[model samples]
Each structure stands twice: as structure tokens, then as C-alpha cells.
Target: MLFGKKKEKVHFNPGNRDDGVDENFVEETVNKIDEDDVEVVLKNEENIDKKFSGNNSLSKYMELGRIMVSMLKDVKNGRYKNIPWFTIATVVMALLYVLNPMDIVPDFIPGVGYIDDVAVLTMGVGWIESDLHRYLDWRLENDLGI
Candidate 1:
């Protein structure tokens, strides 16, 4: 029987993927955030801009989530180019990781569990920080009507 060539597997390892995010950094950052106390980070960039400040880590966390959304949106709108595949994968994976009920640490665990989600978000943001900054600058310029 003839058949097409078998496709290579594409694995996305959130803990140690490319785009420069290492496990060490993610673990360290995750340990610092009080996941149990995390609240709504932000509703919009303007809110982040106005409300993000020193000692406001929750807001920054939300900002990272929003940045992921914005990046995905920009990709859909054809505003981004040459985006690294790992970056895209990281964002989608992180988003999914956050919502997945069955993870290394389940979300229903209450206090300590959300830390995993936060860790995913934090590391995902770290991997795509430059891309996020570029998108953020573009967004700010366009939003300002400049």
C-alpha cells in the first residue's frame, strides 16, 4: 500500500521551549507571585497604562494576558509578520494551559494551583516580551490617533 510520508510531530513544551524562556526563570517568577491573591489584572491597555505601577503585580499579570490577546488579534488582522512559530505556540499554549482544568496542578485546588497558570502566563509573556512590546507600541500609536 502506498501512502503519504508521515508528518513530523510538533511538540510544544511550556516548561522549556525556545524564544529564550528557561525553566529556571519561570519557576523563580512563579514563586514570587501570590497566585491565591491574584485578581483581575486589567480590562484594557489604558487601564494598564494608568494603573500599572510598582507593587502592582496583579495588574502586570493581567497586562501579560492582555498582551497575548492583542498579539493574537494583530496576527488575525495581518498586522504582524515573520512572527516566530514558537512565540505563537507559546501564547496559544499558555492560554490553553490557564484554562485547562486538568494540569500538573488542577485549577480547582484553590490556593496553590493558580500558581501554575500564573507561571505559564508569566513564562509565556517572558518568551514573547519583545514581540509584545512592538505590538504594544503599535497599538498605543494607533489608539492615540497618531
Candidate 2:
């Protein structure tokens, strides 16, 4: 009977399904998308670097709390004055991480982790290394060992 066939229960299990459908398809698709996305992002970032790496502002204190703390300590101790743009970038990224509605690793997944936050933070730090010395030196001279 049509209704009887519809009512019959059919169970599909990834490990035990008798049909030739490969259960790993879903996992493979997700992995491929992740890889492709990463490559595209890297290319885009490289292009952006060539255009606007200069004249960027430092991140706000709230965004770069640790860096801010360090800089602030230096300021109080008379060691530094202005925070660097890279430092600001790190903070801005942090702010995005904390406040952004979208997560690098979507929150829905149970086991996998997030890496976008780390990537941005790393880029920011690397960008700031060269200017760090100059900023620190200026702070030291103006703040008298802060």
C-alpha cells in the first residue's frame, strides 16, 4: 500500500549503510571549502598589503588590552608615549573577535576550533615589529624611562 510503504521506517547510518553512498562526503566537502577559503583570503590580504599598509592608526586601548597595559605601564613609568599602528591593529582585531557576530569557527560545530582570530592577531603583531623600536625609544626619551 502507498501509505504502508511511507510508514515503513528506513534507517541510514554512515558506518553501516548498505547502499554505496560514501558517508565521508560531507566531511570532505567541508574540508575542501575551508582550504579554498583560506587560499582566497591569503591572496586578498596580500593585495591589500601593497595598497594601504601606510598611514594606518594604532588600535584603541580597549581593543588591545594587553598591549595597552604594557604601553600604559611604560607610559606611567616614563618609558613610552604613543602606541604603534600594528598594536592598534591587534586591538582592533581583538575587538572584532569579541564583538563580531560571525565566528571564525562557527559556534554550531562541536569539536573543531577557530583560527581567524589568531591569524589577524599574528598579522598585526608582525606588522608592528619594525615600528615598535621607534615608538618605544620615543616613549623612553619623553617619559624618562617609562
Candidate 3:
């Protein structure tokens, strides 16, 4: 008789979509990033190559960093949250590239390996640009600028 007990029903309801934080919104924003923007960001080697300013450009970088944290938090809180697949893909690919014995351009060639890391990360970060903008606005409103 104990084994025959009925299982409870599971219900699912998608959360509100108005907030810019929605995964669909983030995904759409990332998908819209074009080659020109990539080129612009990449061409400025100073921006890409230099170590992230301790505080300068801090807001933009923090915006991205926050989204990553927030996504994890939301998921932990039982919300129907989803991280954009592309972000995961980029990170995984980068890690795989590192683990593989062979590389497109060996790390032995100074600067090239770091450049590849920057490029992949830049693309992943750029995907969440819209969320970053929202995060920046929040930082600005709260006077949190670096």
C-alpha cells in the first residue's frame, strides 16, 4: 500500500518577462551584436590587450560579472532562469582549446595565446551587453562608478 501512494503533481509557470533580465531578452541582445562592433572592440588592442583597469571601465566589466553572478543566484532561488547557451559554448570551447595538446596558434608565440583568450571572452561578454547596460545604469543611479 505504501508503494502505491500517488506522486504529487508538478506545475510550471514562466516568470515575468517585462524586466530586461529575462534570458530571451539577453539572448536576443547577444544575437544582435554584429561583426563591426567586434572589430571595433578588437582593433583597440589597448582596450582588449591591456589588463582590465582596476577601476576604469570597471562599470562595464562589473556589469558583465554581475550578470554571471545574478544568473547563478536566480537559478538557486528556484526561478525559471536560463543562461544564454552561447556564453556556455564559448567558455567550454576555450577550455577545450586549452586542454587539447594542439592549438590553432601555439601559446609559444607570445601575445597570440592571450589575444585568443581575450577575443573569446570579449565575444561572450559582448553577448550580455544589454544586461550590462542595465547594470551600468543601476550603478550610475546608485553612484557606484569606479
For each candidate, the alpha-carbon lDDT, in order, equals 0.54, 0.38, 0.39
Inter-residue clash pairs, candidate 3:
none
Candidate 2: tens digits of C-alpha lDDT, residues 1-146? 11111222222233433544443542343223322232333334333232222223322322333443354345334444354322433333443443332577752343332244344444444545445556556656666442
Report the error of model 3 at residue 127, Å: 1.0
> By summed lDDT, which 10 consecutive residues of candidate 1 come out lowest?
1-10
Off by over 4 Å in 2: 1-65, 72-79, 84-90, 98-101, 107-111, 132-146
Q: Rank the candidates by TM-score, best first.
A: 1, 3, 2
Over the stretch 35-133, how does candidate 1's per-residue lDDT look in tens digits?
A: 121222212334433322323555666666666756655654556553554555556666655656678888567566567777777767776777777
Candidate 3 lDDT (Cα, 0 to 1): 0.39
| Displacement of the residue 51 alpha carbon in candidate 1, Å | 20
User: Candidate 1: where is the Cα deviation over 4 Å?
Assistant: 1-57, 144-146
Which runs in model 3 stand beyond 4 Å of their true positions?
1-108
The candidate that wins on TM-score is: 1
Q: Each model's TM-score, in the order given? A: 0.56, 0.33, 0.33
Q: Which candidate is the best by lDDT?
A: 1
